[model samples]
Target chain A: MQNKLHYEFEHQAMATQFSIQIVGEEYEDAETASMLCFQRLDALELVLSRFVPDSDISRINRMKSGDELLLDFETWDVLKKAIAIHQKTDGAFDIGVAEYVDVFRATKQGILSDFEMVNALQSVFKKAQNASIYVDPETPKIYCVQEGMTFDLGAIGKGFALDQLSELLEELSIKNYVINAGNSSVLAKGVSKNASCWSFPISSAREEFAVQLNNSAVSATGTFFQGDHIFDPRIGQNICNSMYERVWVSSQSAALSDAYSTACFLLEKEQFNELLQNNSEIAWIAISENGKIQFFTQKNIPLAQYLIS
Target chain B: MLAGTGLVLANPFTASASVLSANDKVNVAIVGCGGRGSGMIFNNIPKIPSANLVAVCDIVESRREKARDRFYTLFDKKIKAYENFYEMLEKENLDAVVLATPDFWHMQHSVDAMEAGLHVYCEKAMSNKLEDAKKMAQVMKKTGKLLQIGRQRRSNDRYRFTHQILLEREKMFGRLTHAMGQWNRSKIWTMKPNKQDKIDISKLKQYGFDTVDQVYNWRNYTKLGGGVVSDLGSHQIDIFNWFLGSYPHTIYATGNNSYFNFEQADTMATILEYDTPNGPAIGIYENISNSRAIGVYERFIGDNGAFIISEGKDNKIYRESRVKSDVWQKYIDAGYISNMADMKKYKAKQSGDSGIMETAPQISYNINEMRDMDKVYNLPAHTAHLYNFIESVRGEETLNYDAETSYKSEVCIYKIHEAINAGGAKVTIDPLEYIV
Candidate 1:
């Protein structure tokens, strides 16, 4: 019989396929751990997914002005991360821009006139720009000061789930594992079967780079899935012209990597260096309009490194 | 704080706070301190302003202490922790206790809490044994105190709307004919103990657990829990009873340890015969252990229309093609159902031949709750269930699923288990078995 040292389990959640690959453990043990982890992921979706009707995000969307709603700790943890990233990215990564995002999606179906798309953007621009949501640092309490702040966590939820799963892996005492969500987000911890770091390829239209990752996450963000147009919620402008063809970001947590990659797509070339400097631990790669790929990483980062090209 | 005891004093109903009057709030303590119990403490209780958490109890000392510490870390509030149940009841002046223990412990814990003059909200499949479940319900009637079972969907906004408005008042699905539900998990495996937990073997045996694996995965064992039928079927099967307003008179079930040698059925299917007010309807339910196909949901079919709903993301309303669009147009106007994507119009738009709306081509509709209903239940299902119980404790509203009503579903559930064990024999039930 061939020896089996690794077990793989796949779960679908948050509109993306998630996978857990555990190594150096018995098949049944790894399978059970993965099942329990998937159970946690499913539980998180019940509280986090917007389409679930009774999710905390859905409840938050139905909140009125001055509503002080307490949230699930998991939901609160994600929202707290989202709000912080919203500030760090200077509003390029905003969940409140869902109304604007929906319009762009609608324009893709070929039913809406160009004029209608433009009009829709201008109308919700004010709401998206002025949207404010606050969280109590002491508790997972949301203070909704503005009404009708629609949110879609499509940008960061998968990464958040991966981050939570990594912690679960540590608790399960599984020393080595790799988790991938939707093929866009990946989190790695410990080592692989061969004792090297877990590795995956990050690619764009013209080039690909193999990344060695452990105890960190790498997230690739692009607009090729639904539509090419992405709105920079800060100015409510469709940055499809200026948006990068692809962006990849690596950080200590997938939640950060996911948010920053999406945010990096809307950033100007000059803003990249400063944002990288501000977040010294984070590294990124961006494919510009011309298909030229740029890579950046801080010194002393060993695990999450790409061959500089 | 209780003098000489580790338990915290439960705030009396007259205790006032910053937000609501003390009279409006109910002092609640949670037992179990496990996964579901932690969810109640963090996900549900915090959202209900009228439910004040006073203490937590668990047979596992570390679990209770960890829950207490986690609570203080998250909310900046202190809560008492205890390892013994009777000690907690003797010390904390609680108005209610939320029990999220193993199925075998539910009856004893719930009955004790009710006898102590405290309202109780216990998780479902009331007990592993049918008789134990009936005993808990009987105590609920004898004590005259509130006892709400945690069949949370009974309080879900979407579910309640489907039952109260679409099915009952509007008769949206005329003459319910059939119902189906499934919980398709990929694998049935035993749980591994959390390495971080400090398990005390001697303490565990007092609660009928001799190993950490048993405590972590009680539902996988027959002696401690009701197996897959309790873990998953209890929730979805309860939905059928609630929507149909009657119990199944006959059950035919088949299952085997196809993949695992666990005591419970690894893969099981049951056919329930329900005599509904509409007519005699058949309900089919299944739990698959080796494959996660088609996911989990409850589908209710009738002559006029059928709708599939779940606590997860599988909720959609479908109309029979023969029924004209105008028949559901009023439901859309009433906010009971909305956004029907007529395939004819959708395909026409897809081909650029019409100005009609473009959507996926299906006789599918997106069901919606009324804006007013949305406002009232802007909380998680468990939070809504817990809120309903707290409200009942405060005399503001009655329970969504009291113990006596939930026992009806448990009666059907245990019968399904029996049929599975008897090699899929057809078992007939007397209607009197459903009543406590």
Candidate 2:
């Protein structure tokens, strides 16, 4: 058996940091693969980043009702995935929450008074909920049937990009790799030389355990970074409850892992079980305020037991 | 000041003051009204209250006309527009002229403007051809006119703070040993000539352009521009030289147009050797046309720390773990640096929960706070560069990057260009060659 070396590269994108680690016989090939992966990530960011004035998402946000615009294939595919997830999550995961984000940001910055912030947030929520955003996946054309609809892909853009990175790496014939978007989301492929399966830790106050992941992605979501900034579209307000401290989801698809992790943070236990019943590929672990853990998948029962122990 | 060997110091502002009065508004004219030129017209000139834009000149008629109308509409002042630069130089009583023309025309326009008794602010990669670039410097020396090269990073507040305070004063990153910079961008620089913006072929040929696209997107061709190396690499490489305080001794480069299929090489990487005062160091730079992945930034690594600095918000400083934490704590206390994972700013209630264990302490400077401070204290990069020129013309400040200093970096850039064109050849630059 040949011992493989690992190479890693770190870069900043989507207003956060991302890293790629690959195990290969040669470092140069791994470096090249990493560069190519970052290129795909950059292209995705140019289309998806709301900060870019001319990005497709930004252009869509600025469009009036009845305006039809052409979107890139990548943008169209991501939106299709987003719409499907929105349906699966029963509208718990909405991309049209950018308006609420803007209002919250304004209020935090003291740009809007409390009365104005409430009125503005309520107005934007109503518009966004009622706004008809039409997407033709075949033609990749988007029509804004109603105005005041804005999209913020912050929750899922990184995972979507990581999936693209995986595709690029696979195209290059590089098999063993682990790509991480910040510490919140990760995609792992193949096992390391020393281990039979790639292992990641699931930690809580009372205990910590290692879950072996192979050809899979894991995404964790919490109020750890910005504190209750994740707005629940159903409530038309941010999630301030401390009951759900953190939620982690593992799936073969990074996009699904990211979306479900976010949805699980707000979903009831029975609701999450229902979601898992329909989508058996996903495995989830959620931690509550009292350091209690709950597991919702039997994909790898031994690994789950190893983790819980 | 002259040396014993009769070498003039190449200081263009030492002779005499041309625009002396504090109250006098410096009359300025733009020599090129294309992308960068028009940027200066709309963005830079409007920000400088002491400078008045008096005329606009370009070979393209529509560009000059639009520039004229833009200035008129924005400032409510009538400015003259001309196709011939000499005609504009002859008519306008300009104290300074901003040369945003193509690399091939930089020498002719800057030399002419200086000989016409006006100060000059010429854009970077001073010229495509080395001889023309040298002559621009020589003319500045002979004519005794202030010539400021548009290496706008010299005027950037963050860069200045990094060089002056962090590196020089505080010795933040000790014994700088290596520097690397990259400018990766997608293939979108090519310009398609709009029907309304098209120029007659005869007029284009008169300006030495064979096609309208060539006239608009000059940087893509070798005859009119210096390709990606000179167009993009020059900016970052200049920073390497500036911060290192030394010229590169040797250069080896490799580039190809395999991806973009453009006339010039679309991707290039160069390794530069330098002997700084501390010791010998290496500089590596690459510009890729197919990937805007890492975006653009320059990193300086040392024994104790490293910093990633750019005009963009992707600026950061990191301290090596071997160094004592207390050494950097003073900088953090003094607000020179900040923790990369800033937990204090997060409003989340801290649980004793250990969610994930980090492998290492990711320490990074608080660039956002620094940038916000920059907004209150400093002008934007482009406006600051132009304002520096205007101030130097008015005898308020000396030129930041005089022609001679800029020519030295251009010499190294042209060598890298030569090596890349020769297919990964290594070029040795003599110390004497840098003395323009």
Candidate 3:
């Protein structure tokens, strides 16, 4: 049996903490590889971050209606993924929530007064349904068909960064790695030493539970940190008082898992079950406001039995 | 002026009092009114209380005029514009002059200004030629005038604190082993001149510029600039030499103009070998003009800890995991280092460990604001460098990078350029060559 050593590196990116852990024998190579991975994340942030005044996404948001802007391949790919997930989640995942996000951030910074907040929120909600963003399927160009349309990639950027990190690590030929971004999004490959699967702890207000994951991505979304920061694009309002305090989704793709976890947080039980039935690759665990935990999975092995044995 | 503010010795070395008060203002002029020269006029000089913009000088008439117009628009001071630097020096009673000319012209302009009994703050890559750089330092020695090089990182508060307080006093990042730095950017650095701001062709030809584009993008030429190695790598490599307290003994470098078909190399990498007091160390630096992937920063790694410091907001200090956490805890408690993750802002409901899990322990330091009595200011690094020069001229502060010290790093840079131009050859340096 080969003895494996665990090495981790931490960096701040995309306004959140990112960590990469690799179980390997070559520690120095792993350290160098981790830095290179973070460099890739830095490049992605420069393209996807809306806070950067000159980022491609920020430039797109600033474009006038009927103006077409060419994008970098990475930016175009992420936006296409976002559009696909938006349709799959039945309008649950939307990137055109920058208007409400701006107001919320301004209010949090104490820059907006109560009356101004009310007016901004009403205006954002009014324009929420008419998000006329168009993307050319053949070319890497996006045209904003309606004025006042903007994008905030906050919900999916972390996952996209993780995907990029995974590609970088794979390119370096370093396997058996786990990447986590701010404890909200996670992706794992191979397995930890002496274990068939990588184990992570999921906790609610009442109790804590451990889940085993292998070659899969998991993301947990909740209102526990920033109150009501998550917005529902369908109604253009924050889902502040949802029944579930937290929702965790595990799937084959981090972007899909992240988008679904966010979408499932505001969904009713029946709606979530129906969505899960259609997407067999996704499994979810939700913790309610009353501290009740519910588990739903499509795998042949029962999750409760797997947890016990 | 003497009635309101008490008169003091205008020149400490001279016997004449001149009835000059400390607040009487130091008359200043600029020798090259290009982008960098005009930037100092617009961005830095206004922030300095003791500086007075007296004259602008450039071979190109439009550049000097534009600089004159900018200073007048910003400060409402109608400064005189001159076509020749020596003529400006002969006419204006300037206490100091900023040399922002091309790398090839820095030696002559700075030497003339200092010989004329005026202090000089010359922009870096001190000169495109090493012999000229050496002569400039010799003139500063013979003239007994202050010559400040524009290595702005030396004046930055964070870098100062890192060098003077953290490394020198506290022995932080003990026994630095290796240093790495990079500056990457996309696109060619070309400027489009306004139609109204165009200079005549004969004027540009007389100024030794073949075209207007050469005047704007002089950095892309070998005669006017130092290519990527000296233009970008010198600034970061100077930090390695300063922090390591040693000049490189051997250098191996390779560069090419593959990305941009300009006269200068667009991409370059150099390996610098240093023998510090603690042990032998090395420095690696690279500059790529085709991709701004990692941006720009310098990283110094030691046995105990490491730090990534830049003029940008990406500055951070990290403690090695092998070091005792309690040793770093003191810094965190003293506010020298703060957790990179702002755990205070968010409350985790079910906490075993709420944040991302890490196998290695890392602690990061955030840049703290500079606090005066009631006013707190976080001046940019370039402004601080200019402020330092202005204060040094008043005999209030010593220069952070004197010509003699800066010449040592320039020697190393020129060696790398030699190796790169020789098609990736290794060059050795005599220890005596490091001294001016």
Best by TM-score: 1
Off by over 4 Å in 2: A1-309, B1-23, B340-361, B367-377
Best by DockQ: 1
Summing lDDT over every window of 10 consecutive residues in candidate 1 chain A, give the lowest-scoring window. A300-309
Clash list (residue pairs), candidate 3: none
Model 1 chain B lDDT-worst window of ten: B1-10
Going through the candidates in order, the fraction of native interface contacts each one reproduces equals 0.21, 0.00, 0.00
Sorted by TM-score, highest first, which candidate order results?
1, 2, 3
Residue-wise C-alpha lDDT for candidate 2, range B249-364, written one tens digit per residue: 99999999898777889989999999998899999999888776778889999999998887654667888989897888787677656563233222222322323332323445
Residue pairs in clash, model 1: none
What candidate 3 gets wrong by more than 4 Å, as runs, is: A1-309, B1-22, B340-363, B369-378
Better of 1 and 3 by lDDT: 1
User: Per-residue alpha-carbon lDDT of model 3 for B1-436, expressed as tens digits?
Assistant: 1111011111212232211123758899977876568667865676566778789888777678878886675456789999877778888899999988889889988998889899999999899999999999999999999999998878766677777666776787899999999998765555444334557778877677888777767898888888788878889999999889889999999998888889888988999999998899999999988776677899999998988887543567777888987787666666555553322222222222433332322436553322221211133456668778888888877888899999999999999889988999999999999888
TM-score against native, each model: 0.88, 0.58, 0.57
lDDT against the true structure, each candidate:
0.79, 0.76, 0.75
Whose TM-score is higher: candidate 1's or candidate 2's? 1
Deviation (Å) of B433 in candidate 3: 0.4
Please give, for residues A1-309, the per-residue lDDT of candidate 1 as tens digits. Answer: 134397788888777799999888887678878977898998988888878888888777766656767678787788877877777788788777666665665555544445566766776765544544556665556766556467888888989989888887886788789999988999998777765568777676676767778678889877678468666777877765655777888887998899888888888877877787788657654553556567766645443345432
